[model samples]
Target: MEDFALEHINDSRRTILITAQLADSWNDRIKEIAPDFTIELRPWAKAADIPDELWENVEILFTLGAFPTPEQAPNLRWVQLYSAGANQAFTGPLAKSNAIITTASGVHAVNIAEYVLTTMLTWFHRYHQFGSWKQEGHWPDEHGRDLFMPEELRGKTLNVVGYGSIGREVARLAKSFGMRIIAMEQRPDHRDRGFLFPDIGDPEGKLPDHYYTKDQFQQALAESDVVVAAVPLTPDTRGMFDATAFHAMKESALFINIARGDVCKEPDLIKALKEKEIAGAALDVFADEPLPDSSPFFGLPNVIMSPHISGMTPHYNDRVAMIFTENLRRYLKGEPLYNTVNKERGY
Candidate 1:
């Protein structure tokens, strides 16, 4: 595809490139909103498969990970990323460009929030130990048996770091379980600016009992029984949870991270777990994916680790298409787009 590069191919018209999987299903929707656009539904697994010549007129791009540099697609006006997090797009070659970037932000909010709640309850109920008993077909004796422990979700404080769509949904559900909310935000505001599913999240931001900024993070950490880190992966957030941060939390606080792994320092977290710096944890994302077989998190008894699947759902593309189609409609009307990444804030 590199060999197909052109010195100059000018086109004063907008073009849309749909390289994401299930492109065929969304083509009509794209055409509906962008009838004037030169639509190209070329489903590709890698950027190299896309010919360079196609970039000349490409103003809109929708893809999973595939991307062309500024030079390759200089006419690019808007980029619709398949994933909710715009971290990769902001950090990649397009970082310097003026192209408008939007994300599938609200798509995974519901599923990820549910996953966080599941992990929290799993730890609270100690069901993992019961799994061992069921596997051996053995019943626990009365000495350690208390099936109805009455340990329910009530009056517990949940500190949510980075109050975005996922955090908002989590706050909404945790509230339903009678948990008080404490939010620690980067800018410390209740107003949600991203794409939202109707009636699904804390849209008005009235859920939080108290809102804390990053400067007061340690204090917020100490007050919570559970901490959910759902902040986007950015320069300010990467490795933000180090030894000092973990130590600031109450020793009994349950750490739940459905956000990017790099947000927490892996080795420090392992040490904290081993030393009982915190009660336990449920980690979906990780600093290293496939979580390296040699990683200490795998051996830690108190840690609930998954292969970074908290955001997955059967309706992923369906929801993504909602945000994309709506954005397309707005684009046609020259209205402000949804979930546009903040160049300064880096989300």
Candidate 2:
């Protein structure tokens, strides 16, 4: 088949295949941008639900789950991912395909950033202890000062391991609290362009006190009062936060992971927290989904575990639609797509 994107350069009619259910108004919203395009909406609960014929004609694929191979989608040209992380999508035939992949990287930044703040504030303000007191109907006269004193975020150092959309948003919010920020990214010199929501994060790159590359990651960890893992899962980043990285952190520093769970070895993190190598950790993602019921994280007092809900928000679908709309406009104009994943980097 001729390159579908190139073939559609002057054509207004195209085919968009989406897995997730969309409201009638949202469908209209998409049609408003590309009125001539035909859309096929399916539940996409299973990968095999999409028939070979459906894959053969789809020019654009919009989905959260179910990654179809290039062999299956012969006419596929672009993939608009509903998820921020593209680790799962970049596997098997999809990794080597000629189709362009764009992520909703900035879409979830707001909610994830808020989750990070909530996790940190919950620890610093001793909300967990207060909740326990409320449950027991016991009011402490000293406000649990002896047991837990409130710590302010002001003047504290925040080291963001990945300076992407989520990390930048975290830094933006942290800066408002008077916290100092440092960040590590694969390329500090490269600035992210083509974002529709510039107010959502540090688009100007002024939030971080310093920027460090991978070589200086350990140095970034050692100086932080709070360490946040917001990088993608790649060959170089898988198990990046091992025992050595954890041990390099300040004994009193708290760790927050809003990125992929596999970024840090679960056993290594458990050992670090158990040994008090790091003060505590709040994890939103895990190495395994529905993190096994027998997992020790459920019972750990110093650990705050959530079921991968950091990126969740009431407006998620709407935000995603906006990203898709912008990318669609670019696609019609034959412009470079936003959040284009570098296959070699695996982001």
Candidate 3:
């Protein structure tokens, strides 16, 4: 076998296989990074039409929107996922394959953190309801009396459920606004590390006073003024936030879910909001994409909903492309990749 050298691999005119649609800018960026490499764009045709010849010669397989079964690409060595979440692709044959899988993780962190803050501010300031009030010509006495019902984020405790890239960014931004941050993760080793808030200059090394395991999540919820769910949707996380968990939150506490929709039980959340178990919620992702017209969340005054776009921004594609390109360089160099998911732990 030939020794795989980073420079040599990139210089060999190797064919790079892209498995789904690539934005024009992203495609151009990839070419800029690996000018010597041949780019092969393979849009999602039927599974039967995936060319075996292309797979045989390709050195890297870039998966955008869909994943190929391991059997479909026997010669594949590396699989770079375009999205942050790899749940849809990490299964069956691909799970067992020798291919090195990497995801676009940290790329969306800043954008998502901004989204969380925007939603939180909107709810706290009552912007949504105010818009409705303006449209209905129903000005309340408070509106004319120069009174505003605004909630303060300062001095509030924000509990982040998963301290991954996105969670880290959210914590940093929250800290900037004078909010105390708490984080919980499954791994006990990361409890005091405070890697999540390091970006905000460490803030005098003030680590979360309360670090809880999955078993202690209820206790975390009880003290949290705001609970932000950034956990991925794994077998353990799916439908994890049900009635019981919601009921554990303080009656005045707010909930924010920027994680997968399935991680929360929609019906249970509705019940919690209706019964005043929680003050309010801001949901970016939902169990169903483009939530059905009949979904109760649309009609709920206490909930703020977005179409699963907390991580979206105008520059998102460019950032994703840059991360993927850098990781490709790392892969060729045999260097450690950032944000590598634990397949067994499922992120």
Candidate 4:
């Protein structure tokens, strides 16, 4: 680790190369914060067209879109991705490289967690159906018993998959709502690492009474009343929650996904909902962006869908910018970056 830190500092004329499409304000902001660092904006150049001269001294690559192959930038050391998910970042040649990759993992945790809770509450209270009732002025036609909705979250179990920063935040908020929380994280020694949440008695502890390892993921899914997918997309996680996994869940369980849509197969989810294998689902991301109008999810009564806006809060850009700026400082000081993604895990 110390040798890695030294390598970054020893590099000459540390250039942080960024893609063209990023906002001018973002470029100006980076320059403002790290005036000594050479911030290069390379636009209109294909990955192969990246000038060999630019690669000579470039130490860090602040990537927004698909990264150039490592062979294209032989001297590249660190990659700071704009997106929280590092699936695309770890592919083919890039995956085989030794570059350190970090993501904006925790940047959207609070906002996305809030979105999950809001969607869950909406489903629990039947807000959309109630709105339809009011619009039709049909409330008086139904008896009180017929119109009453069943269940609340007070004692229900919320199983959070992939106990990263976002998962921890979701667990903390769920616990505050008097809901039982179960978390599944990747680390074998997660309890001792204190990364997602502190130990049970630690002041920073955010975990609930029960936590599960990768080996126990199936058990967690079986007992959950609400299953929240907060896991990152990786080779191992692609289509992780397929038809068989859905069948393992309780018939009345509500599923919420704030993670990548590709993590769950679209056809499998549609089939599960249509066959009543699961109670309902709220999805904020899709395998395809701007979910096609022909998609079956749009017409499903038991499905709640959004246009991948779970992480888009009022201050989203500001929050992302802050994280990037702080990371720039770390990059300059030869310090370890935050939210570093494991290349092998691809998250």
> Of the candidates shown, which would achieve the greatest lDDT relative to the real structure?
1
Better of 1 and 3 by lDDT: 1
Deviation from truth (RMSD, Å), model 4: 3.9
- Report, for every candidate in turn, its global Cα lDDT versus the true structure: 0.84, 0.83, 0.75, 0.75
Worst 10 residues of 2 by lDDT: 1-10
Off by over 4 Å in 3: 1-14, 19-37, 43-49, 142-147, 188-209
The model with the greater TM-score, 3 or 4, is 3
- Candidates 1 and 2 compared by TM-score, better number: 1
Q: Which ranges of candidate 4 are over 4 A from the true structure?
A: 1-3, 6-12, 20-35, 41-52, 134-137, 188-205
Best by TM-score: 1
Q: After superposition, how far is residue 126 of candidate 4 from its true place, in Å?
A: 0.9
TM-score of 1: 0.93
Write candidate 3's Cα lDDT for 139-233 as tens digits.
Answer: 77854634347888888999989877777778878887888888886555553221122253222324555567888989889999999999888
RMSD, every candidate, angstroms: 4.9, 3.0, 4.5, 3.9
Cα distance off (Å), candidate 1, residue 56: 0.3
Tens digit of lDDT per residue, candidate 1, span 1-347?
Answer: 00111122245576899887664667787787777788888776567887888887888888887788889988888889998988766666768766778888889889999999999898888876678689879877887688525367799899999898999999999999999999976544577777877888887789999999888988888888999999989999999989998999989888999989999998899999999999899999888787889988888888887898888899998889888888888776677788887778777
lDDT of 2 by residue, 1-347 (tens): 01224556343445788886666788887788777778888855555888887777788888887677878887788888888778755676667678888888888888899999999999887887887778879777785556667999999999998888888889989999999999986664636553558587887677789888888888888999999999889888999999999989999999999888899999999998999999999999999998999998988888987999888898888888888888888787777788887777677
Instruction: Tell me the number of clashing residue pairs for each predicted model.
Output: 0, 0, 0, 0
Clashing pairs in 4: none
Candidate 2 lDDT for residue 295:
95
Measured against the true structure, the TM-scores of the candidates, in listed sequence, are 0.93, 0.92, 0.85, 0.84
